[model samples]
Target: MSSRIPITLAGLAIVLSTASALYSAHALREQQQLVDHLNGQVARIQPYAFSRSDLDALLSRQSLAVAPPAAPEAPPAPMKRESAPIVGERRYGDATAQFSLIEYSDFECPYCKQYFAVPKAVVDSSRGNASVVFKHVPIHGEASRREAFAAECAAAQGGNDAFYRMAGAIFSSTAGNGTGTEKPLAVIASSIGLDGAALSRCIDNQEPLQKVKADFREAVELGIKETPTTIVRHNPSNRQVVLSGAKGPEDILRAMAKLVQGNGAAQ
Candidate 1:
């Protein structure tokens, strides 16, 4: 019996050793395969890569400007109606253009900063064909809220140019900490050559503040919890296309084209 017990123990050890060796070999092969696959993908992407500007251009056309708020709640009033532009908000292009892109952005968001150039290009490309309606929904921190008020003040006093300038300056420069502190909205207004006193007065006043608050409420209602949420509206039929995210520009162009086609077909 003792002799048989020794034989059984030896056999068990050998089997265990063989299994462990096989398992180690399998794991090594899997690791190698994973590495090889990753390398191949990297190589594939390396050749077709783009510069930051080029990447941004590509990203801009894809139509992702903001993400919907994680916990979306209905706005106090109809989002489409309640946040209607008052006297002091920033607006660009014709009041009667066939289509309008409404952008709800936080000045502090890096993605919003990246998207800033896109609207400029789109506006320039439109050449009186389309218009962009701007709204301030400062969802970041205190500085963003301050800038929102400043933008409103600029729009109220200096009009679209002032507001545009302030927005452009703030978004164009990568100088802030997502708080209005690093690049104060007031300074941006000053850089654009707007009247300092008027900008200050606009910021200090409550009317513009109220308008901004209304828009923020509207944004909440629309489930906008992120930096940039864009609503593309076809003016003729009052159709709505809600695009949420910091998507690529190509996507935006495609969506716009598809929208135009669909609208044309419906007509």
Candidate 2:
């Protein structure tokens, strides 16, 4: 009887140990499943949490996945209207023409250089219908101012024709950006058949500086800021069209046509 009792107690102990081991294993598996479920929920909710760092990271990944955007196109140049009358002394073409192109230019501006011949081209193309007037804006400091004075001095020596000739010589010779020319102003004047010594005297005496300053002040009052600003005015009706920048001859012609058409004149 005693031996049977010992064996029974040993068997009971072994069975209890086996059941505890199985329970522990099952509990471990359930705990692992709960952890996995919690991790999955956190991942799903992370995007909506609005965390800046996480959002930035997501945006970066998206940007890398997509193609870059195309480059933007340049904007068109501006054209506008004004009521200012055409005012300048250096006139080219017929004085009695119906329309006048008043060119406010800088001798040392590259854009002014580009547009040097455009006004003359328009005048020529207009036949007897249009003219041009030159005004000095000399915004490129002393070099431009000196050139303006020299051209005016040519006018003083010769007349309107000499002024235009001097202007042409300067425009043709200058390297732009305040560099007047490789040749001296007087030399350029002589080359153009003006009295170079007299022109130099005129410049030294500052005879034409006031004319340049007046033009600049007039431009300021009219709100003209950029180089190569052209004012197309109809002498008959006092209608004005302002063109800013280095516009081609065609652009001026087109503006002229529009003005003529508006006035019920023949094309």
Candidate 3:
């Protein structure tokens, strides 16, 4: 039975190794969670950290003067809320809130990925004052469109929370401006604890795709020519500021401050 003792000891050692590895992994994950939480708080405070001169220079670089609507007759996109659920069903903040910030972006666009941080900062700063809206302008063709569909499906299944989680996954996994592959996209759906089989069915249907397409059509109509476009408006006042291209945290907050101050964009 001496041989049996050695085999038993080997098996016990393997078990201990695996248990140690799992515990280490769990500890690392917890540490990561704490770090991410602290970082978010720090990032939220960063926007307000700039001085007036710094903000002015940033705004000047942004050409703080927004361009006039291309056509006075054709309504500018994202500017009007006559259309309810402006960002569709996936939204954050008090539904009855008076301020609105809209971001038009593509899943495959790296700049768009970076700007995703803007909404949280704005919404957090606004507190009960502002609402964030997400508009899909998936410009990288079918692959991007597929990713958009996946996000919508997640929303359909688990509402706005799940939608954001899936987006975080897409933006985090996708490299450069490169597209995320189908398998990774599927994995994202599953990671969010969404129904993967149903997501597949939904993507196959493509009927829900109309929501994103409509946003695209409206963007074209508004002459919103690029990804990472931001539209900030204060309700009742209805003042607006439309910013195109990727913006630094200072740039976006200052632009948004125009709406919050009820100044709107300079005419």
> Which candidate number has the best lDDT?
2
User: In each prediction, how many residue pairs overlap at the backbone (N, C-alpha, C within less than 3 A)?
Assistant: 23, 0, 0
Q: Worst ten-residue run, lDDT, model 2?
A: 50-59
lDDT by residue for model 1 over 1-267, one digit each (tens)? 988999999999999999999999997786465445434433443231212221212222222123344664654542332222446446688878666777877776667776765655555555454577787766555566667777777666667877787777767754444545455455666778876665665554434666777677767667665556677776766666776655444434444554554442331
lDDT of each: 0.61, 0.72, 0.66
Name the better of 1 and 3 by lDDT: 3
> On residues 184-263, what C-alpha lDDT tens digit does candidate 3 reach at each position?
56677887798887777776666356688777766666777667788877675767888777765556555555554446
| lDDT of residue 117 for candidate 2 | 80
Model 2: which residue pairs collide? none
lDDT of 2 by residue, 107-200 (tens): 8877787787878876775657788899887766578878988888888877789988988899889988877777999999999898788778
Every model's Cα RMSD, please? 21.3, 34.8, 20.4
